[model samples]
Target: MFVDIHCHLDAVKNASEKIALAEKENVSLIVSNSVDIKSMEKNISLSKRFPIVKVALGIHPSEALSMNEKEIEKAFSFMEKNLKKAIAVGETGLDFKHAVTEKRRELQRELFKRHISLALEFNKPVIVHSRNARKECINILSEMNAEKVLLHWFLGSKKLLFEAIENDWLYSIGPSVFENPAVQKFALLSPLKNMALETDSPVLFNGKPAEPQWIPRIAKKIAKLKKTPLKKVETVTTNNAFRLLGLQQKG
Candidate 1:
C-alpha cells in the first residue's frame, strides 16, 4: 500500500474520480489538507464519502495573510471543534516567498506557531508548507520541540535538511524529484525511513496536474536515487507515512 501524505482533495475538480483512480493504483491512504474553513468542511465530507480519504485541517499561510482577526479566530474555533475528524493539522507554515515584507513574514510566523500549538494540544501530526522560509520554520519547530512533523515539498539547504533529519522530522517527497535536482538530492541524502511520498494533487507540475496515483512514479524515482529495490522503497515509505500519521498500516 502507498500513502500520499499531503494533497488538496478539496481543491481538486472531480475529486471522487481522482480518489477512485488512486485506489486502483494501490494508493491506500490520502491525507487531504485544507487551506481554509470551507475546504476543511469539504474535506470532512469527502472523508465520509471515500473510505480511503482522511483530512488535515489548517489554514494555508497565504490564505491566513488576508484574513482578519475575527476570521482567523473563527477558523481556529472550527478546527478545534472538528479536530477529531482530522488526521493532522496542516497545509500550515511560513511562505516568505509570497510574504515578502518583514511584517507579513512575522504575521505568518505567528500564525505558524499557533497552528503548531494547536497540533501539539491535540497531539496531531503537522503537515507543513515552508516555501522560502524553511530555516525559520525549522527554528520555530525546534524552539517548540515539536515532534510528529512532516515537511512537505521541502527544498531547504543541505545543512537545514540534515538538521531536520537529525531531529527525526519526516519530509514528503513529491513528483518534483523527477525534474528538480535539489529534490532528487534530498531523496538521495535523506534516509528512506524518514521520508514519505506526496503529490500535492491538483497542483500543476510541469504544466500537468498531479494526482495521488502518481505516488508509484515518485517512489520509483526515490528507489532509483537510493539504488534500492522498489519494493523496499515502497514498504519503507508507506510505513513511514502510516507511522507519522498515527494510522495503523493496512495492506
Candidate 2:
C-alpha cells in the first residue's frame, strides 16, 4: 500500500470521499498535515474519526506573523494533551519570499525554532516548508538537531540539499518535479531510500489541479527518471514514510 507522507486532506471538504478513492486504489494510508492550531485540531479530529488517516500538526511559515508565545504555548499544551493522536510536527519553516519585513523574518525564525523544539520534545518527524530561505532553514534545523525532517516540495539550493543528505534527512518530492529543474535534479541524485513523495493536494499544478492519487504518478515519474523499477521505488518510499512516522506498514 502506498502512503502519502504529507497531504492537507482534512482541509478538503470532501476529504472522506477522496480517502475512499485512495482505499479503492490500495493507498490505504495518508498523513494529514495541518498549517496552524485550528487546522491542527481539525486534522486530529479527522484522524480520530478515520483510522486510515493520521496527522501532523504545526504552524506554517506564511502564518508565522500571527503566532506568539501564548499561541505557541497553547499549541504545545494541546499537542501534549493529544500526543498519542498525532504523528508529526510541521508544515513549518521559513518563507522569506512571503515575509517582507525584518520583524516578520524574526518572528518566522522564532516560530521555526519553537516548532523544531516541539518536534524534538515530542519525538516526532517535522514537515518543513522552506521557500527562498534554504540556507537559513538548513542552519536552523541543523543547529536544533532535527533528526526526522521532511523537506516538503523543496526548491532550494544545491548546497542545502547536500546538507540535508549529509544530515540523513528525508526530502519529499511533489508534482513540481515534472516541470521544475531543481526538483528533477534531487530525484536524479537522491536514491529511493532517501526520497519520499507527496502531493500537497488541492494545490494547483501547471494551472491545473492536483490530488492525492497524483502521488503514485509522481512516484512513477521518479522511477522512470531514476531508471528504477516501480515496485522498488514504491517499496522504499513507503518504507521511509512508515519508518519516519513510527507507523507499522499495514496491508
Candidate 3:
C-alpha cells in the first residue's frame, strides 16, 4: 500500500473516478489540501464520504495574495471553526516567485504565520507550500517552533534543505520526481523515514494530468533513485505519512 500525503482532490476532473483508480493501486491515504474555504468545505464532505480522504485546511499564497483583507479573514475564520477533524494545517506558506505585490507579501506573511500558529496550537503537522521564500519561511517556522512540519514539493536550495533535515522536517515527493532532476535528487537526499508521497493531481505528469493512482509509479521512481526495494519505499513513505498527519491508526 502507498499513501499520497498531498493532493488537490477537488481540482481533479473526476474525483470519484480518480479515487477508484488509486484504490486499485492500494493508495490508501489521500491527504486532500485546500486552497480556500470552498475547497476546504468540499474536502470536508469528501472525508465524511470516503474513507481514504483526509483533509488539511489552509490558504495558498497565490490565492492569499489576490484575496482582500475581508475575504482572507472570513476564510480563516471558517477554517478555524471547521478545523476539528482536520488531519493537518497545510498547503500553506510563502511563495516569493508568485505575482504578489509588496503589500500583499506582508499580508501573506502574516496570514501564513496564522497558519503556523494554528498548527502549533492544535498540535497538528503543517504541510507547507514554500518556493523561493525558503529562507523567510524557514526563519519564521523556526522562530515559531512548529511541532511537526511537512514541506510539500520543496524547491529550496540544498543548504535550506539541510536546515530542514536538521529540524527533522518531512518532505513529500510529488509525481514530478520522474521528469524533474531536482525532484529526483531530493528523493535521493531525503531519508525514506522522512519522506511521504503525493501526486499533486491536476498537474501534468509527462503529457497527462496526474492522479492519486500515480503514487505507486512515483514511489517506484523514488525506489529507483534511492536504489531500494519498491516495497520498502512504499512501507517507509506510508509510515512517514501516518506519522506526519498524526493518524496513528496504521494501515
List lDDT for all candidates, in order: 0.91, 0.82, 0.86
Residue-level lDDT of model 3, residues 1-251, one tens digit each, is 88988889978888999998899999988999999988998999888889999999999988887788798889889888878799999789988788457776787789889999998888888888878787888899999998599888876677887888888888888878888998787788877877888888877866798899999999899888989999999888888788777777553
lDDT of 1 by residue, 29-89 (tens): 9999999989999999999999999999999999998989998999999999999889999
Off by over 4 Å in 3: none
User: In terms of TM-score, which candidate is stronger, 2 or 3?
Assistant: 3
- For lDDT, the strongest prediction is 1
Q: What is the lDDT of residue 128 in candidate 3?
A: 88
Better model by lDDT: candidate 2 vs candidate 3? 3
Superposed Cα deviation of residue 51, candidate 3 (Å):
1.0
* Most TM-score-accurate candidate: 1
Q: After superposition, how far is residue 41 of candidate 2 from its true place, in Å?
A: 1.8
Best-to-worst ranking by lDDT: 1, 3, 2
Give the 10-residue window scoring lowest on summed lDDT in candidate 3: 242-251
What 10-residue stretch in candidate 2 is worst by lDDT?
Answer: 76-85
